[model samples]
Structures are given as C-alpha cells and as structure tokens.
Target chain A: MKDDYKDKLDSLPVDIKLRAADRLKIHLMRQKYGYFSRLCLLMALIGPGILVMIADNDAGGVMTYAQTGSIFGIGFFIPFMIVMLPVAYIVQEMTVRLGAVTHRGHAEMIWKRYGKFWGAFSLIDLIIANVLTLITEFIGITIGMRVFGVPPLISSISAVLIIASIQLFLRYFAWEWISLSIAAFNLVFVPLVFFVPHLHWGAVARSFGTWHIKGGVSSLFIYVVLANLGTTIAPWMLFFQQSSVVDKGLTVKDIRDGQFDTFIGSVFMVIVAIAIILITAGTVYGLTQTPNLDIQTILSAISSKMGPLAMRLFALGLVEAGLIAAIAISASTSWAMGEAFGWPKSINMPPIEGWKFYLPGVISLLIAGGIVLIPNAPLGFLNLTVQVVATIFMPAAMMFLLLLLNDKEIMGEHINKHWQNISAFTIVGFLIIMNFMYGLTVVFPHILG
Target chain B: MIKYIDIIGFNGKRCDMKNNKKTSKDINLDEDWEDFIKEEGLIDYNKIPVQKAEIKGWVQIAFWFLRIYILVMIIMVIIGFSRIK
Candidate 1:
C-alpha cells in the first residue's frame, strides 16, 4: 500500500503532488483512533483561520489600536474589543466553509458566479485596497526598524525581498507554519501590559459596565470606532482566509476544526488588541491629547512610563505585525489574481513553475516598499484612503460572501444556517450605518461635534 | 499509450505535453485514489464552470442596495478628498 501510494504521488503534477503529499499525511492521521491522533489531525487542519485572524492585527491595525488606547483610554474599547471577538469569528468562519465546500477561493467564486462586471469590480477594489494596505505594512516595518537603528531604504528593501522569497520558495504548509511562528510574536504586547506602571485592574474590569465615551461622542470618537471596526474585519480577510483554506486543501470534514481554529484565532486577535489598548491607555492616555497621535509619540510615552525595554518590545511587536501581515496580504493578492485569471494558484508550486501566480504579489510589495522609502510621501493621506476604501468595499465583500454562502447549488448541505444569516446581516447593517455616519462626518467635519 | 494534458503555463500561454504516458502505476483502481482526492479536496475547479447565478428575489434587492451604497460612498469620498487640502 505504501509503495502504491508513492507510485500514485509520483504520477501527479508537481503542485498537486506537493499538496497531495501533505494531505496524504493528514489522511493517514485520520485513520488512527486515539486522543493523540485526534489532536494531531486537528493540528494539521488548523492554519488558515488562525493565520487570517492574527494577520488581521496587521501593521495598520496595531497603529489603530494604539491610537484608540491613547485617545479614548481603556474604558470603551476594552469591552468593545471583547465584542469584536464574536464579530471576527462569525465573519471568518463562513470563509472556511466556503473554501472547504467548493475548493475555490473567494475571487474565483465571485468571478465565475456573478459574471464579469461584479468580478472586475471586486478584483480591482481588492487589489487597490491590498496595495494601499501593504504600504501601511511597509510603513510599520520601516518605522519599527528605525527604532533599532535600521534605515528605511534597507528595511523596506529587505522586507520586500523576505516576503517575496517566502512566497516564491516555500510550499503552503511551510509557508503557513512560518507565518504563524511570526504571528506568535504579536503576544509581546500582552506581557508588557503587566509592566505598565499604573495599570488599574479595577478600571479595566469596570469598563464593561461603563463603556465610557471620553468627552462625549464626537467626530473623533466615531472615527476611532470605525477605525477599530475596520481593523477587526477588513475585505482582505475574506479573500485571504478563503484562499488560504482552499490552498491548504480543507474539506467539509475539516470544517469543525476550521471553525475551532477561527474561534481560537479570534480570541487571540481580541486579546492582542485589548493588550495594546491597555498598554497605550495606561501610558499615553491623559498625557497627550494631540489629534495627530503617531506611533513615535506612543513609543516615547511607553519609554518614559514603562522603561525602554517595554518600549523596545512594543516596537518588536509592531515589526512582527507588519511582517506577518505583509506575508498574508501579498499572498492574498497573488491568490486572488491567480483565481480571477484562471492561472494555476497554490503556494505549493515551485518558484519556477509558479512565476505567473507569484508576480502580482511581488509587484505589490515592490510598489509599497518603494513608496515608503520616498521622502515626504503622503503617508497619512494614504492611511486615510485605506480606511475609506475598506469602508466602502467591506459591505460589498460581505454581501457577496453572504450571497455565496446562502447559494444552494454551490454550498448544498453546508449552507449557512438561519442564525448565521441574521448575524451576518446585522453586522452588514451595523457596518453600513457606521460607514454612513463616517461619511457624514467626513462631509460635515463638525457634524458630530 | 500516450496521454497529454493541456495546462495554462506562464504568461497565459498554452503548453501541450507531447509524450505523456500512463502506465498501470498511474491508474489507481483502488480506494487510495478516491481517499486521496476526498481528503485532499482536489477538484479541478477550472474544468467545472460555475453558471451565472440568477440574481432575483432577495439577491436582486441586495444588488440594488449595493449599487446605491457604492454610489453614495463614492460621492462622499470625492467630497472628502476634494476638501483634503
């Protein structure tokens, strides 16, 4: 049987062969009956959900959380982030089922099912938002590295090379494991919370009751809320996770494990988000009420309040956030392009064999990395544009996801339950309302005020 | 027997294999192939064309909603960016 299996594998194409090799291990693991075997099988099945959730706390997300903490303190956002766990989980879990049931990425599903116009619209929006978001990742990378005496040019170039090489060289399994390993470093902020000089546990616990809005509700408050929402669930996450699951070869049998993976990831994402909020709220809140609260300001506040080591650890976490997100985002770009264009798409493909699939991602990285190194680029404007694009595109993405999930022909038995539709619609409704309010705030700068 | 599979290669070019051959080892009539395909979730998705969905009932309403939503958002963005300076 072993010889026969090897013979069968040898007869397959290279990309499929690599994926089959990994899936073959999973197949064998499934045949065994024990607690240990079940644990092993779960370990094998859990990657896409966790990776997507952690990558959700991208470089831009880190800055947003830090800014939220500094501006609003821990009162509102702590409990708010706790609520986001379910929001993040509910939104991401659908992707797992979509991928597992159809063996197709989100882009491919949209392209084929919805016809060309909506397909082009989605692909263009995704690619633009992804490139802009990648710029923020590069910004985080360069800024964080500058703390350790590295220049922007070297850091940006090196980051591009590293991310591109990882995508080009590694198979899907190795790529996922390496990316998750980097994601683990995002926990650096969690422990640094303990070192905060005057972090009051009572205040943290009491936040659930108050959900306090500092200085009443204003435009700044709405902007911060929307920013946090944007970070928690972005359009990239939908495309990325579905593509990741498809690439990792998840099936209906693994859907439960995939959901569990997403749940665990959601917990981690919220914990890290709250940790950053707590760290900044403890240190920077009430110290500076500056409207333009950049990360350098936050880092300095951490240095003065919590010593240089904690500050440095925070910087390290920032770098990891940027790096992990770049890997995930760029790969999503590549995956989406391949899916839309009917190209062979898999991280398992060898570099030479998969150059077409790898080009879009690498080009995006170069554009972002190069832009960050240019002196006096409008980075703040770019960041705001990222928010605006995500705001506009998110609901559309969700609508498509909901449409696909509810489709009887594609999903069959794995169709979304009644509760799932209600929950998703409620999320969409909330997002549209918030986006409308956000737009109003933009049009009328003092509307909320 | 010679078999050929046309694959889309680099740059959207179609490359055809000339001397592809299948032997007994390649033909897995056993349960292993089915198990492998099932576990791997390997579907030739490119080969199976998904039909254009009939956008009616609630789906049409959703599409209309999306169109209005996007148009409104784009106008707001234009206004917002116009006032950026």
Candidate 2:
C-alpha cells in the first residue's frame, strides 16, 4: 500500500505532488476512528484559518489596539473587540467554504466568475492595499527593532530577506507551520497585560455593560471605530485565506476542521487585541489622551508604568506581529497574481519552478521594505491611504465573496445557507455604514464634532 | 495530430516527450489513480473556464450598490486629500 501510494504520488506534477503527499496523510487519518485520531486529523487540517486570523492582527492592528487603549481605554473598545470575534469568523469562514468548494483563490473567482473588469479592479485594489499595508508592517518592524537598538536599515532589509526566504524556500505545509510558530509570538502581549500596574479586572469586567466612549461620539472616536473595523476584516484577509485554503489543498471534508481553526484563531486574535487594549488602558490611558499618539509615545508610557521588561515584551510582540503579517500578506500577493494570470500557483512549487508565482510577492515586499527606510518618507500619509484603500476595496471584496458564496453552480452543496447569507450581508452592511461615516469624518473632520 | 507526452517523475520534475515512445503504463492504470485524484483534490481548474455569472437578481443590485459606494467614497477621499493639501 505504501509503495502504491508512493508510485501514485511520483506521477503527479511537482506542485500537486507535495500537496498530494500532505492530503494523503489526511486520507489515512480519516480512515481511522477514535477520539485521539479525530484530534490528530484536526491538527493536520488546521493552518490557513488560524494563520489568517492571527495574521489579521498585524503590526498596524497592534498599533491600532494600543492607540485605542491609549485614547479611549478599555471602556468601549474591549467589549467592541469581543464583538469582532464573530465578525472576523463570519467573514473568514466564507472564504474556507468558497475555496474548498471551488478550489480557486478569490482573485481567480472574481476574474473568471465575474469578468475582466471586476477582476482587474479587485486585483489592482488588492495589490495596492497589500503593498501599502506591507509598508505599515515594515514600519512596525523597524520601529519595534529600534527599541532594541537596531537601526531601521538593518531591520527593514533583514525583515525583507527573512520574509522572502520563507516564501521562496518552504513548501505550503512547512511554510504554514513556520508561520504559525512565529504567530505564536503574537500572544506575548497577552502575558504582559498582567504586569500592567493598577490594571483593574473589575473595571474590565464592567466595560461589557458600560460600553462608554470617553469623549462621546467624536471624529476621533469614529476614526478609531473604523480603524478597528478595518483591521478586523481587510480585503487582503479574504484573498489571503481563500488562497491559503486552496494552496493548503483543503476540500469540503476539511471545512469543519477549518472552522474550528478559524474559531480558535479568532478567539486568540480578540484575546490579544483586548490584552493590548488593557495593557495600554491600564498604563497609558490617563497619561495620554492624544488622538494622534504615536506608538513610541505609547511604548514610553508602558515603559514608565509597567517597567522596561514589559515594554520590551510589547515591542517584541510588535515585531512578531509585523513579521508574521508580512509573511501572510506577501504570500497572498503571490497567490492572487498567480490565480489571476492563470499561472501555476502554489508555495509547494520549487523556487525555480514558481519564479513567476513568487515574483510579485517579493517585489511588493521589496517595495515596502525599501520605502520604510527612506528618510522623511510620509508614512503617516501612507498609513491613512492604506485605511482609505481598504475602506473602498473591502465592501467590493465582500460583495464578490457574498456573490461567490451564494452562487449555486460553483458552490454546489456548499453554497451558503440562508442564515450565513443574512449574517454576512449584515456584516457587510455594517462595514459600509462605518466606512461611510469614517469617510465623512475624513472629509468634514468636524462632522462628529 | 501531434502527440505530446508529459511525465512527472519521482524527483517532481516534468519531462516533455517529443521523440519518446508512448507507453500504456503512462495512462495510470492503477486503481488508486481515482482515489489519488479525489484525495488530492487535483482538478485542473485553469482548463475549465468559468463563465461570467448571469447578473439579474440581487447580485446586480449588490454590484450597483458597490459602484455607488465606491464612487462616493472616492469623491470623499478626493475632497479629504484636497483639504489636506
């Protein structure tokens, strides 16, 4: 039987062969019937979901949460973060099902199932948003490394090399496992929350009921709300997860495991988000109520209140968040380009074999990494642009996802149930309203004043 | 018709067969071929061109909504950036 499997695998194309070998393990695991066996099967099947969710909490997300805590404290955003878990899961779960059913990435589906115009639109938007987001990630990386006396040039170049190498050298399974290993560092913020001086668990618990915005519904509050929402469900996440599911070779059989993985990842993402909120809320909230507080100010506040060790841990978490997100974002870029152009796309493909597949991702990484090192670069403007681009692109991406998920021909039996559609659409509707409000604030600046 | 043979070997490299003899074994007569394909979820999706979906019902509405939403947002952004300038 082993020899037969080997011979069969040997006959597959290079890219598919690696995926086949991984799926073959899953097939064998499925034949067994036991509690432990089921657990093992789930462990084998879980990657894309957890990776996507955790990677969603990228460096920008870290800064967003920290600033939320600094500006508003845990009064409202903590409970708000709790609401986001389900939002993240509902939006992301559709990708798992869509990928499993269609075996296509989001870009390919939009391109083929819609038309070139929409496809190009989505592709261009995704690529632009991804590049801009990558710059923020690199900014986070360089800034965090500065806490440890590393120069921006060294940190930025090293980050690009590390991310590019991970994408270039590792196959899908190793890539995911390695990325998950790095993602585990995102939880470093959770443990540091306990070290925050004068953090009141009682006040944190009371936040669920109070849900109070410190300054009322001001422009800053709306901006923060939209920023949190943007971080929770960006357009890249949709493309990332679907492409990840397709690349990981998950089928409908693995959907249950994928959902569980996504749920677990969401739980962690929210937990870490709340932890950052708490850490800063406890340490930096009263110290600084400035809406435009930079991460350096927040970190200095943390260091002042929580001691150097805790602040260092927060910085380490920032670096890890940036690194892991860079990996996922770059891979999503590569995958989307490959899917749209009909190029052979898989991380399992060898470097020489998938050069075309890897080029776009590497180029995006280089552009972002290089941009961050330039002196006097308008990173603030770029960050705002990332938000604006995501704001515009997110609804369009969600509509495509909802459309693809509802489509009967491709989705077949896996087409979204009625409840799923209601939940997804409601989420999309809520996102659009918030985005519109955010846009209004951007334009008027005094609309909420 | 020109016959082309594409063989994937154990090293996971593909070989083009212009002058190579076509062999019956290359057809994958093994019973596990079906199982392998099924288990691997190996559909050559690129070969299957997906038709542009018929946009009549709610999908059309969603697209129209998206168009308006994008237009409005772009205008707002333009105004916002102009204010900044």
Candidate 3:
C-alpha cells in the first residue's frame, strides 16, 4: 500500500525475509525458553493440542475430581488418571494429523469423506453439547463467585462480558495466550493439598501400587468414574483440536510439535486432577470417612480446613478454568458448525467475514450466562444432561476420528500402526465400559450412581 | 490383537509439500511460506501424500472390529448392571 515500503520490500531478497522470519521466531523462542534450548520446538508448535487438552479439564472437570476425592478419596482415581494421560493423548493425536494433513476440521472431513447425514448429526450434536458445556462452565463460575460474596447476577453478566471481550478483540495467538494464562490458575488446587493436615503419603503411594476403590464399586463410585471419563474425553475435544489445527494453518510438518504440545497439556491435566483429588481426599474423606459425598461437601471441607481465603482461591480457580474452557469450547462449536455447513471459519477472520463462525459461540455464552442468572435453574439436571449427551456422542465421534486417521486416502501413510491401534482401541473400549457403567449408575444407584 | 496395525507406526520428519500430489489449492495458506513449516516429531508428515497403493483394508476392518467390540463390552456392562439390580 505504501510506495516507499513496497520498493524496500521488493529490494529485500526473498531468502533474506524468510531468514528474518525464522530468526525472529528463534529469538522469540529464546526469550521464552532461554538460550541454546531445543525444547523450544514445542513452544513454537504449542497451540491447538495444549488448548484442547487443558480445556478438556474445564471447571466442571475440577469439580468432578474434587467431588470424587471428597466422596471416595484418591484410592483409585489418581493412578487411573495417570493411565488416562495416554488415553487422552492418543485420542487427541489423531486430530493433530487430521488437521495438519487434511487442512480441514473434523466436521468438514466428515461431510466430505463420510456423508451429509453423519455430518449434519455431528454439527448439531457439537453445537448442543458445547452450549450445555458452556452452561456448566457458568454454573461453576456462579457457584465459585458465591464464595467471594458476589451476587450471581453480576458475576454471570460480568463473566459473559469478559469472555465476549476477549473473543471480540484478540487475534488467535493473543487470545490463546490469555486463555492459557487463565488455565494456569488451575494449579491452585495443587497447593491446597499441602495445606491439608497430616496427609498420608502412604495412602497416596498405595493408590498407585494398588489402585483400590475404598467401598468396592458402589453406584456413586461408578457415577463418579463415568463423570470423570466424560469430562476427560468429551466430544468437544475432537471438534476443538481438529478445528484449531486447521485454523492455526498447521501443515503436516507441525504434527510432531503439535503432539508434544498435547503431551504437555495431558500431563498438566493429570497433575491438576490429582491435586484436586489429593486436596479433597486428604481433608474431607480422610476426616469424615464419608461415602457418597458431593461437590458441596468438598467445597465445605476446603472452607473448613484451609480457611475462607483458600476456599475463595479454589472457587476463583474454578471460575477461571470454566471461563477459559467455555471460550475454547464455544469457539469449537462455531467452527464445527461452520465447517459442517461450508461457512467461512477462522478466529483470524473478521467477524463480518465469518459471522456464522462467530454466531454459535456468542449465542452459547449468552444463553448459558443467562441460564446462570435464571433464579436457580435446575443446574444439577443440566450437568447430568451434559454427561449423558457426551457419553452418547463420544463413541460416534471417536469412531469417525479413528476411521479417518486410519484411512490411507486421507492420512496417506500416517495411518495408525499396530501398537497405536491397540492403545487407542483399548481406550475406546474402556471409555465405552465407563459410559455404560455410569448410565447404569444413574439408573440404579443402589446397584452401580 | 486388533490393535496391532502398522498403518500409523512409521514416524515422519519434513517432506516437500509444494510437490505433494494430494496437496490442494483450496487451502488459503501463506503462499510464500508453503515450504517453511516444520514438524519436529509427527511421523505422518514424513510420508507426505498417502500412497493409494498403501491402502490397508485389513487395518480398517480391524479398527471396525474394535469399535463393535467396545459396543459389545458396553452391552455386557448394561446387562450385568441390570441383572444385579
């Protein structure tokens, strides 16, 4: 646009500009990672994968882990989550490849490769599930805000506006950094574990060696387990990662770096989950020897054991986690819908160019935020709906991801190898079992919630 | 046993995407940097375009079997829970 700059730009050798870009990238990475560090490779490639996995353990997820620890303690779930790190990583790895190679999102791939029927189904399911998920996020924020004595009305409205402002202004990279900063607050639960008096290191160690459930697979145990699984590997993750990969302009070359990002996110997720469990298990379950406790029980334990300050911190962490995940998941919803319908889609695009891409996420945040204000909506019921919908939807979502990944037409030689297949199938089988057990737990609590 | 497929086993490094046959122009990539992207660990990128001759129907079938296996496992769990109640 400027004649003088245009001449300068033309005068610069093409290789010089390319080298400048690469050097600038290296310099920035050095600033972030320190000099002579190679692991900065991941730092450069760490967007979609890390974001998806962290967002998976949203506000609802932290609550579930806390409730599980308060009710059942960390006799089993801690080690189980360590095992699940790979499970979450395995399922998510497919998206990195699919996004990089296909240059498309999950919804677009489905519509093109599978058919319209399944594509339409995935689009609708993604939107509804994401909206419901956002509602749960609002639930988390409102409940957590109550700890700070903030009125629910102001908290929900303020939360909605903050999320909208971030979405409206920041480009993808800046938005991602801001969201990642909020996600880092999820670490507050880790320190709370230390505040718990006389935590038995022996019991925590035993959980890994034995993986025991305290009360021998009761309905509550199964329900908690299902809730945990649903929270960890929800359908939104697939939509989020694939769409993010496409949006990030990740080519096939970025796949490994992407997987590394995913691996880091998974480790962070597990650690945060274990922290909540440790904090609650050390305080509530150990103190009361209670069975079948709920989220309120855990929150009260935090308040009683760690004081109002710690409790407020926990609630603040929940609000931030939920708010950040809501942003990511809501974006996932719009992207998936746009991909399915062949609408222009990208966080990088102007709102006008991609209004449809912006629509679903905005509407979801607004509606969910409003629902949070609706004089005590049947929120417990809504949480259950989130779990049930995710359970029903997960297999179909995984099925398509697995099929597409293994497809030579789409993935070329990137198809699942023997060991990878074994690992993935095992996870899928385990998830299905977990979901079925959860359904039964809800139906016959005495037998399994 | 169905998990033992080699379809995705091979890890890849960088490949020439500019000449990749499967690469499409529909993608609005940064045209100038088409050759600059580099993945450190992802193997699939090394293979570039999946060679059609490499299509493994057996692997696809194996993946399908695993899917049904999960469904069957869920059905069994439901039955077990129902009977227990």
lDDT of 2 at B59: 82
Instruction: For model 2, state the Cα shift of residue A132 in Å.
Output: 0.6
DockQ of 2: 0.19
Candidates 2 and 3, the one with greater lDDT: 2
- Give per-residue CA lDDT, model 2, range A1-449, as digits (tens): 45666677778777777787777656655655556556767887888888988998999999999999988987999999999999999999999999988889999999998999999999999999999999999999999999999999999999999999899888787789999999999999988987888888999999999999898998888889999999999999999999999988998888998899889989999999999999988888877767778999988988998899888889999999999999999999999999999999999888888899999999999999999988999999999899889989999999999999889888999999999989998999999888888888887777789
Residues A114-202 of candidate 3 have per-residue lDDT tens digits of 66766787777787788888998988888888888898899899988988777766556557778888777877777877888778888
Per-residue accuracy of model 1 over B3-72 as CA lDDT, tens digit each? 1112211111110122223222343437568766755766567877889899999999999999999999
Model 3 lDDT tens row, B1-85: 1111121221111111222332123332244232233331112221233232232476456446645755654565455445642
Better of 1 and 2 by lDDT: 1
TM accuracy, model 3: 0.80
Which ranges of candidate 2 are over 4 A from the true structure?
A: B1-30
True-vs-predicted CA distance for residue B75, candidate 1, Å: 0.6
Candidate 3 off by > 4 Å = A1-41, A286-294, A441-449, B1-85
Measured against the true two-chain complex, the DockQ scores of the candidates, in the order shown, are 0.20, 0.19, 0.04
User: Residue A364 CA error for candidate 2 (Å)?
Assistant: 0.7
- RMSD after CA superposition, every candidate: 7.0, 6.8, 9.9
Q: Give the number of the best model, judged by DockQ.
A: 1
